[model samples]
Target chain A: MPVEGYAGDGHFRQTYNDIHILCQETAKRIKTEFNPDLMIAIGGGGFIPARIIRTFLKVSDSPESKPRNIPIQAIGLSLYEALPDTSEEVVGKEVIRTQWLDFSTLGDKNTKYGGLLGKRILVVDEVDDSRATLSYALQELQIDVEKQLKELKVSEEERSRIREATKFGIFVVHNKLKPKAGEISKDVAYFSGTDIEDLWVDYPWEMPDILKHDELKRQDDEMAVKAK
Target chain B: MPVEGYAGDGHFRQTYNDIHILCQETAKRIKTEFNPDLMIAIGGGGFIPARIIRTFLKVSDSPESKPRNIPIQAIGLSLYEALPDTSEEVVGKEVIRTQWLDFSTLGDKNTKYGGLLGKRILVVDEVDDSRATLSYALQELQIDVEKQLKELKVSEEERSRIREATKFGIFVVHNKLKPKAGEISKDVAYFSGTDIEDLWVDYPWEMPDILKHDELKRQDDEMAVKAK
Candidate 1:
């Protein structure tokens, strides 16, 4: 069973409160450090956190300022399979595989109207496990921006603005860095809420079956304690 | 060409500020009236409004209150083509053809445990035109709940609770009612931000081309006023 290797002994368990505080702090840090013009959230896991961040970034509460409405972009990217862990395997072994289900361009009108060009962008996700997903997302974003620039018939000034835009990566949790060769590029700045050792982290939003297993285990633990 | 018939003449032109106020007001109304256990937002259009509503309905600001972390669901229902005006005819004719490209079941853990079984649900969208989309969505929700009940082997008490749950529809703009026979059931209550004529409403999130058309028309209107 996948739960057999549960590292519950001293693993850093995070509750919803922990994640929420982290998001608030991360938003503040990003505002001071990066001051990004656009935020791209990796969907599914990143959706809720990204929304919170956008809310904090709102300048005004009024509706007339349509431009002040939260200007975040969402992209769906799924890139992991439950293959056997092979840290000790030979270099030739398949360690991880990726899947890109939907790669639609940014649909937000603000993003289309020269928002992404020549501005700082922050890509947010819940976790940076193995960094494979984030890496692929950043590369794809570069391609998307370049494609948009080619299609847009804009002035030379606008072209320069689009060309000079920078990108950054952010996460709620960052496992202790082992620093694999050429996995994440050095040019992209990275931000994270908390750092931890290499252990399986059980998030609250896991599938129903896994959640049921977790509940059962908790009940069993409580029963054993009472018996003792 | 679609902008030719824009309801700018004596039309209820809404700025971002106006929409924001309406969303807050609508959120308050839903709270006092229905007090829904869950909010299912129609993606793209309903996303921002739903988020605002969820924030207003927050039970607490703490992170530990997992239940209050906006227990909302997203359904991607795209049934429109072209720019704006066709929403009455071509879009209206095909509004019933809802493609659930991402019909993810409600994942809020509380909803899974008991909330959804016998709870009030609010389905939110930006506009209710001809009532086709909202009607189809309500029908689909009924089907989804029934299917869930069938799959889960619950006791008779739980089954009854699930059956007793109700639904409500909400929109930012409700077009003038030209009620068709049995289109929107009388049983289902609906709330709206405002009501306007059957003329096409131009939203701020329009595409660049449509926005440009609006801007050019505004310029021409100003030029005519200056000449007069």
Candidate 2:
């Protein structure tokens, strides 16, 4: 049952078809489920799924109206600590930020969610394993919103008006059912396309040998059909 | 031959396989040809291809070293103008920037680009139709580099040192052979996966009906084989 190179029952390499279908199906429910105005994608992993789901999130006011895509703000996070030189080193499990939201253009008064202050924002990622990255992103975003509110120096009532409108939600293609290393706020709306086992997920993008990876996926599908 | 819904001889729909192969093939050349240190992905369209290409570009220092991804900075641009209300409106062909580089987090002294001052940077996008967006991006980036140098008050010799090392390049999946609306700097290196005719390319992400879109692609490939 083991594929060459990737030898283990714990590894599950997925094909593009399944990921595409999952996004499409999830978008159908996400339409009414979250109905988010903005998306904060944890970069690299979240980029593809965010772009795919944006196709479904588009809305046109009328027959002639242009269907607009929901804006995506990419935030890059890595579980591993990158060394100064290109040498092998895995020192700690700390999260390092490579990128964050561009606040200048995004913070204009005319623009929606000025500095991500008050709007329905959805944080998207490929998978939720330790829940460390998601928790960090949400907490940082909350801090950003709070800081912006104070800096702008708006009236207390005016501040409360935006505060009530502001909300955060989460969407992931796969959420591994395991003991999470981090915690998430219960108040934030959560949606996962599929609940997966606490195993090693070999995403299509990370496959060094895609052909072999896909072949294994095909065989798995065939075995599943035969078993049924 | 024309297909239902998307009826036209000019509109060509691509399957995921073709796109994936194109990225793989292009990455092979990009490794030696461009040898870029960083990537600037034009969001949405560029997001998918950039992620795919990054998979191939990674290089580990040693047997135990982790193959690090060439960091991708996303910039968002759109051809259409967005209105306050969700109403139909076709504005000029001007490119509106939705997102730009995050100067704060990315401008660290130890960072690779050092505010993109002196580095081999590759700007990636899905297609090159009008050549307007790509041109604008390069020019703006040059301006940003100049502004940073001035603000930092870098010495003349030091400025020249980084400036000589600094270079810009481009990579796109499809480049339509047509008279471009905008012009690019001749000195800047350019790379396109494939040169396509002036046809409407329906990318995998834009397919509203993916099943039908893929079926049409299969039929097209079969016809090509039969003709051969």
Candidate 3:
């Protein structure tokens, strides 16, 4: 069975501690499983977690090697073509508002991977929902590396580093419930801090919504009394 | 003696560990001084550091109290009216790109502080340079809270809670060197993980430009060889 999504009854409220610990664990997994030198974080979702994971990677680094100085690149990906007005419009839809592989929004306009010729790379995000986002990211990276190799003339050693560099995906939560189209390539591995069911995962970042909902309810009650 | 800018010989590079440590210390400062129930991260700069500090607050909370369940809100602010064409465009001028207080870019559409009547709030970000961004954030937050309190109808206790709630500022790096306009009210304390002499602090998040520079130099060398 493909390790995709999971089903569950109740929602999972991930606390700050939960996320911090998961990032630590994810860093550990990356060290042993991937040992990546570059971490590419998908913006918004992956940005915060990726930073935490990078910090954790320092502690997880081997005693001998200078702590892995894994440089991070942030890329923005949005499935929506336009912002959906209604909840119904967003349900079960993947209307891409922004391109999945936009280079313009790449967090750093500088490096452009000229220094990453032979580095193992890790692409990270908060969740792997339909798996499409991660899939697109992996494919684009492969295409980018291939293009760079063909265009740049470098020593055989540098060329080999570019050719042999590996890429993988990391997520804080991997939803094993929603069935996605395809898996990340066999050669490219994926790691998650935690596996969660398809139910809603309430993150600390979204607490404002919960607070706002309560406020609206109180206002509605007061208005109803006035109407009566 | 206004803290406006720092003159220095070399660039100050801030490593991942430096940031992580600073965030931890900022959390400690917040515990003793502000004890805020909410954290608002100024986007781009404040997002990551704010989140890390928020996490640290959980650990810093007193043993008897439920870990400070402080909620976070993210708002984006850009000083540039237009992006500079070359790196030189941004050196000396404090360009105004976006509105001083862009609430539209606030991460959540739901709350908008409908429930913030009595809650203590903290505005967080990476740096407090020139202090314009932090100054604007403090003023806007004061205005928003005042507006919400006047318009919304809630219990006397809730109203009191809202009125008593205070706002503070937190930063990973507070460059007291670059002077700006008015300060945040003395009642609303500001906390920083560390302070540095006014100098160019190169963050890991901004590593791309450095990498890009190396790439450009290599390309230039190759071109020179061809010309020869």
Best-matching candidate per DockQ: 2
Worst 10 residues of 2 chain A by lDDT: A83-92
Candidate 2 chain B least-lDDT 10 residues: B83-92
Per model, state how many residue pairs clash.
7, 0, 36
Residues B1-228 of candidate 3 have per-residue lDDT tens digits of 311222232355554445666676666778777777666666546657765565566422456545433445555455532331111113334533221222333223224344444556678767766676676677777787677677767777776665775455555444545565536677777777667666556554444343453344445445546655
Where is model 3 more than 4 Å wrong at Cα? A1-9, A59-69, A80-116, A154-161, A209-228, B1-45, B49-124, B129-228
Off by over 4 Å in 1: A1-228, B1-11, B60-67, B82-92, B96-105, B112-116, B155-157, B180-182, B207-228
As a whole number from 0 to 100, the lDDT of residue B59 in candidate 2 is: 62
Interface RMSD of the predictions, in order shown?
Answer: 12.7, 4.0, 12.4
lDDT of 3 by residue, A136-227 (tens): 77777788777767776778777776586635545544454567654688777678876655555655443434334334444544554665
User: Could you report the DockQ of all the candidates, in the order they appear?
Assistant: 0.03, 0.41, 0.04
Query: Which regions of candidate 2 are displaced past 4 Å?
Result: A1-8, A62-64, A81-92, A107-113, B1-8, B61-64, B81-92, B108-113, B152-155
lDDT of 1 by residue, B1-228 (tens): 122223346343443333455666676787787777667666546654565455455444356533343345555454543322222322354542222322333333345544245557777777766666676777777776677677668897777666765455555444554453226666666788776566555443332233354465566456546655
Instruction: For model 1, state the Cα shift of residue B35 in Å.
Output: 1.5
lDDT of each: 0.52, 0.76, 0.55
The CAPRI category of model 1 is incorrect
Q: In every candidate, what fraction of the native interface contacts is reproduced?
A: 0.00, 0.42, 0.05
Better of 2 and 3 by lDDT: 2
